[model samples]
Target: MNHYNLSSDLELVSMLKDGDLTAFTEIHRRYYGVLYSHAYKRLPDSEEVKDILQELFICIWNNRETINIGSNLPAYLYTSVRNRILNIFKHQKIESDYITSFLHFAHQNEPLADEPFRIKELVAIVEAEVSLLPPQMRLIFEMSRNSYLSHQEIADKLNISSLTVRKQINNSLKILRVKLGTHFFMLFF
Candidate 1:
């Protein structure tokens, strides 16, 4: 395992603020496993673990704007993650999922073997439309929809702040709404 890096968090964070994705990715990769372990130790079930990690990273990035630190990154990340996890564990019951779209997909008839062509065509169309967006907006827009990852996961993977991810998605959806509003509204049936 790569050990906790000795590079000061201040310097690393400076690199992060400059839109350095590589530096940010490294920091996330280094700490993700440890942070998950910290969360899992406090929370029951492996399922909620992913969501907790997402929230933790999102919170960290959101708070990073005004934060300054001299502490080791690992200790700070681990303790912060643990305290957050314990807090959640103490307060909430894990409610059953009420969404049934997942069940709909699970029971749907399997597509024909070559039916993937339809997906490819749809992807091409979406990509073409997304490409017309402003640059950063375009990247975030597609990353949110094309990948199976959640918004926070996309933010972590792209090393952009989660706020940026949410903003981008909001912007993209609004544009899409304007472009397809009547069409979209007609689909509720």
Candidate 2:
């Protein structure tokens, strides 16, 4: 182990390529702290930094036969850490952008969940006000608006003059407008 530690990086790489576990352990001991510090500078999370280093070392040991540091193991390790950190940042950005886009789409395209209840409430208020009108006027107003009958049509159905139907409908509208206010009147009628 002391001899492996004293050997140069090139000697360690050669021994590692032959599957020398001691050489691999020496390499890990020498490079882990430097690589961890390099990664932590860019990514402050302790667990994430540890995972990256762990994965990197595992990959090195698994692929030692084909690994090609070529006498610059420190540079290779640093580059690997940098690339991993950049990949993490890219993944986080994509997740952030997706969340932002989803929120925007929901806000623009989705109606409030309570919209039907609100419409029902508004209709109820308008109906309550309309029910307070004179009986004959309420019938005429309902025929003209709800049944989509013209004044002449309503007059023909009710055996009244078109002018009388028009007057009754107008009076009903005036009463509703006063009761419901101009805002609610316009929305319903």
Candidate 3:
């Protein structure tokens, strides 16, 4: 059995872009646990975390064409998961439920380690999917998501129309809904 290395994400991304599946597996092997745990922290429910990881990876594979990794893949992974989790908090109410799920900690020692990998895979998937959005869509997402701007604020700062801002936000949300599926059912209500 082989373990994974963070130093190799750049190499793996290269191979991944060249249509290599094994490289993805290798990347998955290295980071899935970290990502899964990240998601677990926000999601709390074990079952949903598992599905989220699958969606995350599927999103990555589906959107592998235009991702620019920029050398710090791990940081990118962490930020993406953090954003997604925060998005969950904003859309649904994960903070309280997340606390509730932790009530069974003592019996879950072994499973905890496996959780990170699951979250990280989804981070990878989200990064890939985010990259595939149109240039304006990506810009809107970054300003609102990465920079934590409001719709009105992003519109003013970007000097674009507010309708464009809402459209871009809606576009990103729709894509995420498709990408995340029933795993995010809590988000709608």
Clashing pairs in 1: none
TM-score pick, better of 1 and 2: 2
Give Cα distance to truth, residue 122, candidate 3, Å: 16
Candidate 2 positional error at 157, Å? 99
**RMSD in angstroms, candidate 1?**
18.9
Better of 2 and 3 by lDDT: 2
Candidate 1 runs further than 4 Å off: 1-10, 93-189
What's the lDDT for all of these models? 0.55, 0.65, 0.60
Model 2 segments beyond 4 Å from truth?
94-189
TM-score of 1: 0.41
lDDT of 1 by residue, 50-150 (tens): 88778767766766655553344544565566566657655666652322444676688574467446545433443444444454544544442344566
Clashes (backbone N, CA, C under 3 Å), per candidate, total 0, 0, 16
> Judged by lDDT against the true structure, how good is candidate 3?
0.60
Candidate 3 wrongly placed segments (more than 4 Å): 1-7, 93-189
Tell me how far the alpha carbon of residue 124 in candidate 3 is from the true structure, in angstroms, after superposition.
17
- Candidate that would win on lDDT: 2
Candidates ranked by lDDT, best first?
A: 2, 3, 1
Tens digits of per-residue lDDT, candidate 3, 58-136, equal 7776777776665756665566667666666666643566445556665565453675576666556555554445556
Which wins on TM-score, candidate 1 or candidate 3? 3
